[model samples]
Structures are given as structure tokens and as C-alpha cells.
Target chain A: MITFDDVVKVYPGGSTAVDHLSLELPTGKTTVFVGPSGCGKTTSLRMINRMINPTSGRILIDGQDVAGQDDALLRRKIGYVIQHAGLFPHRTVLDNVATVPMLLGKSRKEARTAALGLLERVGLSAEFASRYPAQLSGGQQQRVGVARALAADPPVMLMDEPFSAVDPVVREGLHREFLRLQKDLGKTIAMVTHDIDEAIKLGDVVVILRQGGKLAQIGTPQELLDHPADEFVAEFVGRDRGLRSLSFDTAAGLPVRPLTADLLLDEAGRPVSWGDGEPTGGTFTVEDSLRLVTDLAITSPVGIAVRVDANGKADGLVPHHDLVDHLAERRAAK
Target chain B: MNLSYLFDAAHWSLTADGSIPQLILSHVWYVVLALIIGTIIALPVGLYIGHTGRGSFLAINAGNAGRSLPTLGLLMLMVTLLGLGLTPVLIALTVLVIPPILTSAYAGMRTLDHRVVDAARGMGMRPWQVLFKVELPMALPVMMSGFRSAALQVVATATVAAAVGLNGLGRLLIDGLAVNDYSRVLAGAIVVAVLAVVLDLILALAQRWIVSPGLR
Candidate 1:
């Protein structure tokens, strides 16, 4: 667990960058610090690694004061990722990932072997091992950044807008892959971002800060979305938070209607285009979030979402009207 | 305007004093020593100022002072003070070599992507490690160009050493002029220009070989 005990960062010019802020970030969970520009979210994230020192107050990891440890030794025990990857342009992809391991005194060959495995884990192929960072696309370079951070397998990871530099489509893919990796690894993580949607999607605890480094609010993504502490948070989370909250709800318990003759199918029992030759609406599995289910229902020409089994065959359908009723009941219950 | 002295076998002979081969070797030697000494002095100072962001004014002013100093005047002054010898010539030439190297090293380190440096620091690299492993490697292309410019300046200016009775390529120009050996003067001018071009080309090749292809 990481604890910030009334930490305050004031620059030499007498301007406070981070106010007397206090918070606790739990272990094995992802906590995101999010705010507008100059809100001290990045400042707070950087303080964990001592990149930005707090003018006063203490930052502790597992009840030990971080200020007491040697700076380099303290940093080596944590993983850090930043926007644009911040990779060494002179090093090959393999060597870049191997850096921290080598710094910790691992032999070159051993570090490289471990780095290759990390490359694959972060969705890179063996072919990318020898290429320089410039040779890879922006998304590919970000993946390498992640691989490099995970090289030492530190118990904690600090990310400063790690995927913000990539395009939205690539960012989504990275988000999915990142969550999958986190699920498997369960490392204590602290991330900073300005994107509310990203914070909701990835953070177990979302910390919203306002200008002057003051805390605006702190809660789960659902709590923040369901009931923002004030107008500022509501505005910050964006105007569509009600619709976005549906993302956390699973569609598994929703009612599904039996498939009708109007539903078109192919020889393999999969949904196909209607006779008009246009493609049928997108499919939603039982495990998909309600947001996707609602999208599938709204877009279907026949007013029903095709529910596909594991084999991609149509199992059932969710009528558009039924989704509306379920969402209404869910909101009323809250 | 006569150029026959360049092709004349007597000028080319190693045994003759002020021969093309002898003059060329002496000229190259002066350039090499000045560059080595200048770099040894300037490189570390530039890097230290750049890395710490301290004494930047010193780096900037040093470069401007180097560019403005009159090389021939400095050589004559040094010769008067230190007496006619290699010391006066070398001292003058070495001054010309300092600015480019110092300024380039400082500029190269200053302009690197700070994000990369931050990442290096955040990843637990000691300050010295960051300087050597990250900053120096990235700054090499710019620093090398600085070195090249310094070398070229040293090569062209070493000829001024002949004013103080030093034996170098400049001797051809000084002696030829005294005896009205216009052909020898032309030959000296031609050889010096060619040497400058060849040295610059070698430096360019060295830069290409030393710099990581990833940077390109």
C-alpha cells in the first residue's frame, strides 16, 4: 500500500504545485490520478517515484518513508511508464527492455531471454527484438515501453498517461491488453491521466483533483459516475456519465428473447446480412458489458441484439425495448 | 599563377626542407595536437554545464569569444611573448579549436528530449550513468560536428604558424613569397585546401561509423 500523508509540493517560486493532500492507494489494484492541467495529478504520480519531491509531508510505501531510502535504489524497486515510451533511441527493442534487468546486475544473456518473453507478453513478436524504437509504430513503441517497465517485475508500477499518445483505436487495444495483463499479474499500480473515460475503464479507484493541487473527489469509477461529489466533478466526468456507467454492468442477467424468423442466419448458424445485403447488427456475448449490449440492440435493423455463443452461432436475441426497461430498473434500484 | 611546382618532383621529395610531403606532415601534426588538447579541455566543461544547466553563460560566451579573437594577431602576440617556437603556434591554434567543440557539446546535451532523460532517471539510473549512457550517446552527432569544425579551423589556421618561423605547410607560402616563388605559393594553397577537404571527409565518415544508426 502507498500512502500520501498530507503531502504538499511548493515550487521555489512559492507556488504550490500539490497542496496538503492525503490519500491511500491499496495494493494489487490500479489507482488513477486524474485532473485538468496544473491540477497536480501528474505531480502526485511523480512524487511516488520521487521525481518531484514534496516540499513537506511524507510519502510512504508499506508504512516505510520513501524519503529515507537511496533515490536510485527506491526507483529500481518500482516500474515506471510514460507517454511516448521515453525509450533509448540508441538501443534496440530487446536491449531497451533488458535495461532495468541489466541495471539490477542480471547478465546480458539472461536479461535478454527475460526481455523476449516480456516482449511477447506485451503483444510484440520476436521479429521486433532487434529493431530500434524508431522502426516501430507509435503503438508498437508504447508496447515496448510497457515491456521495459515490467522487465524488473517490481511490485509497483507508476504510469503517466502511458497510452495517451496513441490513436483512440490503438489506445483501446492497449487498454484491453493492459487490463488483461493486470488481471494476471495483480501488481500495485498508480496511473495518471486526463481522460475521464480511460480512468473509468481502467482505474479501480479514481482520484479527481482540481486546480492548485486540491483533491476534488475520490471513489470507484461507478461511484464517481453515479454520484459526482459536486458540479465540477460532474462536468469533469463529462455530460454522458449516466450512459457511461452502464459499462460496468454485465449483460448476462438481461432478458433475451428467442430468435424469430426475421433474424437472418448463415449456413453455420451465425447472423448474416438481411436480404437487403447490408450486414446485420454487431454481436454481443453474455459476458459483454451493458453498454455494448445497448449498442448492439440500438443498431440492429430488426430491433433485437444477436446473442452469440462461443462458436459464433446465434443463441438468442435481446430486444431493444427490454434493454431500456432493465436499465430503468437498475437506475431506480440505485 | 604558375602551378608547375605542385607537379615538380623536387617539391614532392621527402628529403627536401619545406617539401610538400614534409610540410603536409607538419601541418597535420599541428592540427592533431591542437584538436586533442582543445577537446580535452572543452568537452568535459561543456558536458558538465549542459548536464547541470550551470555555467551556460560561460559556454555561450566562450564560443562567441573564440569566434571573435583574431587568430593571426593572437599568434603574433604569443610569438612575441613566448618567443618563436611550436608553443606560440600551438597556443594560438588551440584557442581556435575550443569554441565549436564546447558550444556543440553544450547545445547537443541541452536539446535532447527531456522526457527520455526523465525516463532514464525514473528507471533508477545514477546521474553519471544517465550522462554517459543516455545523454552522451544522443548528443554525439552534434558533438562530432563540433569536433569536425574545430579540426577544419585548426588545419586552415596552422599555416599562420610560418609567420613565427614554424615549419609547416605555411612555410611554403612564407618562403615562396620571400623568393617570389609564385608556383610554390600556388602549390601550397592547393595542397592546404585539398588537405582541409580530405580531413573533413574523414571526420564525416568517422561520424557515420560512430553514431548509432537508430539516431539517423
Candidate 2:
């Protein structure tokens, strides 16, 4: 777990980038800090590893104060990736990814082996390892950047708008990949983004910071969407946040039920198929949260959406009423 | 100095005990020797000033002063202080070449992306590792160009050493001027210009060869 206790950052010129802010991040989940540009979201992320020192207050990583640790040693234990991928242009992709491992005293052969494996994990082929950063496309470069950050397998990763540089399509693809990786890897992550859509899509915990780096609100996507705490968060989340609340709920409550139930049973007594097409995304299995069901419905305007089986077969359906109430109940609870 | 008159100049030197080969060899050796020594001595100075981003306090003032010094003027004065011969010529040429190299190296290092530096640092690079592995690699292309300019200038300035009694292509012009041999003057000027061109081309090739292939 990473905790920031009354942390603040004041630039040399006396401008406050982060006010006296405090936050806690649990292990094995993603916490996203998001705000407009210069709102100190990035500054907050940088402080976990002491990339930017807090002017006051203590920052603890797993309850250890960073001020008392050797900075390089501290940073070596926390992964970081930046907006442009920050791959060293002169080094080959493999060498770039192997940086921290090599620093941690791994043999070159061992580090290279680990790096190649990570490259594949992040979706780059081993053949691309010898190539330089300039040779990679923007999206591929960012993947290499992620691979490099994970090279040390640090328990926590701090990223500053890692996907913002890519085109919208690539950004979406990366977001999907990141979610998949997070599910599989379970590393605690703190990511900063300016795009509210991204915040809602990926944030297990969303921190909305006000203009001067002060915290406006912090909650799960459902909680923030349902009760914004004030006009600033409500406006920042935009007019459509009511709809945004539903998806988070779907992931939790509405797992696909037995098709034999009163909801939308078909000839085989299954949720009716739109062929093999899924209605609520494939996430609504007996395993998935109702929040997943809600997101699938939002993806399509039709009143009913199907949930898919592991083989992509339609297993069950979720209706608009069920999705809508999930969000409403969450808001009322807040 | 007439082009038509230089044929007579070569004949004139060739007939004077065939001294042309010996003279050219000696001149080449002196200029190349100074260039190598000057580069070695100046590299650390240049890299330090450039890498630290504090060159303005010293590099700008010193380099401007160095650039403005009349090299021949300095050679004549050094002839008295260091006492004429290769010593004065080497001093003058080395002084002439260092400033361009130092200032350019400083500027190149200073202008590099700070994010790149931070990334290297954040990756657990030692300060030395960052310098050798990252900062130096990026700064090399520009620094080499500076060295190129310095070398070309050194070649041009080396010809002026005849004032200090060093036997170089300038010997031809100075002797020709002393004896009113216009043919000799024309030959010396042609040789110096060609030598400068050749050295400049070599420096260009060195740059092409030394810069990383990606940057090239």
C-alpha cells in the first residue's frame, strides 16, 4: 500500500502544484489521479517514489517513509512510465526495457531474458527487441515503455498520462490491454489522466483534484459518479455522469443469471442469442459483476444486451431497467 | 599572384635542390600534430563546460576572446615569449581551435532534453552512467560538428606559422613576398586552400562515420 499524508508541493517560484493533499492506495488495485492540466495529479504520482519531493508531510510506501530511504533504492522498487514512453532513443528496445533490472545487478543475460519475455507480455514480438525507439510506432513504443517499467516487477507503478500521446483508436486498444494486464498481474497502480472518459473506464479509484492540486473528491467510479461531493466534481465528470455510474455497478451486481429465470429466456431456455453476438459484453458470466453488464448496455442503445459465455456464446441477457437501477441505487446509497 | 605564374614557382622550388617534398612533409606533420594535441587537451574542457550548463560564466567570455585574437598577431608575440619555431606555431593554432570546440560542446550538452536526463536518472543510472551512456551519446553529433569547425580553422591557421619561421606552405608566400616572387605567392595560396578543402572533407567524413547510424 502507498499512502500520502498531508503532502504538498510548492515550486521554487512559489506556485503550488500540489496542495497539502493526503491519499491512500491499497495493494493490487488501480487508483487513478485525474484532473485538468497542472492540477498536481502528475505531481502526486511522482511523489510515491520521490521523483518529486513533497515540500511538507510524509509519504509512505507500504508504510515506509521515502525521506529516510536512498532515493535510487526507493525508485528501483517503484516502476514509472511517462507520457512519451520515455524510451532512451540510443538504446535498443531490449536494452531499454532491461534498464532497472540491469541496475539491480542482474546479469546482462538474465536481464535480457526477462526483458524479452516482458516485451512479449506487453504485445511486442521478440524480433523487435534489437530495434531502437525511433523504429517503433507511437503505440508500440508506449508498450515497450510499459514493459520496461514492469521489468523490475515493482509492486507499484506510477504513470503520467501514459496513453494520451496516442491516437484515439490506439488509446482504446492500450486501455483494453492495460485492464487485461492489471487483472492478470494485480500490481498496485497510480495513473494520472486528464480525460474523464479514461478515468471512468480504468480507475478502480478516481481522485478528482481541484485547480491547485487540492483534492476535490476521491471514490470508486460508482461513488464519484453517483455523488460528486460538489458542483466542481459533478461538472468535471460532465452531464452524462449519471449514465457513467451504471457501468461500475454492472461490474459488481448483475452477473448473468440462469436463462431459466423470468428474464429473457429463449427456446433452449437460454438468454436469447443475437446469433453468437453478446448483449452485455462477455463480462456478465456467473463470475462478472453487474457493473460489466451495465457497461455492455451502454455500449449499445437497445433496451436489452446479452452476456457471453467463455466460448463467446450468448449465455444471458440484461435489460435497461436492471442496468439503470444499479446506478440509481448506488447514487441513493451514496 | 597570377595563376600562370605558379608553374614557374613549382619549377623554381623543384630546381632548388628538390626541396618541395621535404617542405610539404614537414608542414603536414606540424599541422596534424598540433590538431591531435589540441583536440586532446580541449575535449575535457569542452565536455565539462557543456555538460554542467555553466559555460556562460567562463566559456562565452573566453571563447569570444579566443575567436577575436589575431592568430598571426599572437604568433608574432609568442615568437618572443616562446621563441620562434614549432612551439609558437603549435600554441597559436591550438589556441585558435579550442574555443569553437568548447563552446559548441557546452551548448550541445546543455540543450539536451531534461526529460531524457531524468529518465536515465530514474532508471537507477549512476551519475557517471548517465553521462557516459545518455548525455554523451546525444551530445556527440553536435560536439563533433564543433570539432569539425575547429579542425578546419586549425588547418587554415596553420599556414600562418611561416611568420614564426616554421616551414609550412606559408613559407612559399612569405619568401615569395620577401623576394618579389609572385609565382611563389600564388603557389602557396593555392596549396593552403587545397589543404583546407581536403582536411574539411576528412572532418566531414569523420562526422558521418562517428555519429550514430540512427542520428545519421
Give the winner by DockQ. 1
Q: Over 4 Å off in model 2, which ranges?
A: A251-334, B1-25, B32-42, B55-65, B179-191
TM-score of each: 0.94, 0.84
**How many steric clashes between backbone atoms does each model show?**
0, 17
Instruction: Put down candidate 2 lDDT per residue, B111-180, tens digits, no spaces.
Output: 7778778777776677898888888888888888888788778766777877767777778788889999
Best by TM-score: 1
Residues A218-298, model 1: lDDT tens digits: 999999999999999999999989889988888888988888776679899998865566567689888899999988878
What is the TM-score of model 1 when looking only at chain B? 0.97
List chain A TM-scores, every candidate, in order.
Answer: 0.92, 0.83
The pairs that clash in candidate 1 are none
Instruction: For each candidate, report its DockQ versus the true two-chain complex.
Output: 0.81, 0.49
Model 1 docking category: high
User: In model 1, what lDDT does residue A296 have?
Assistant: 80
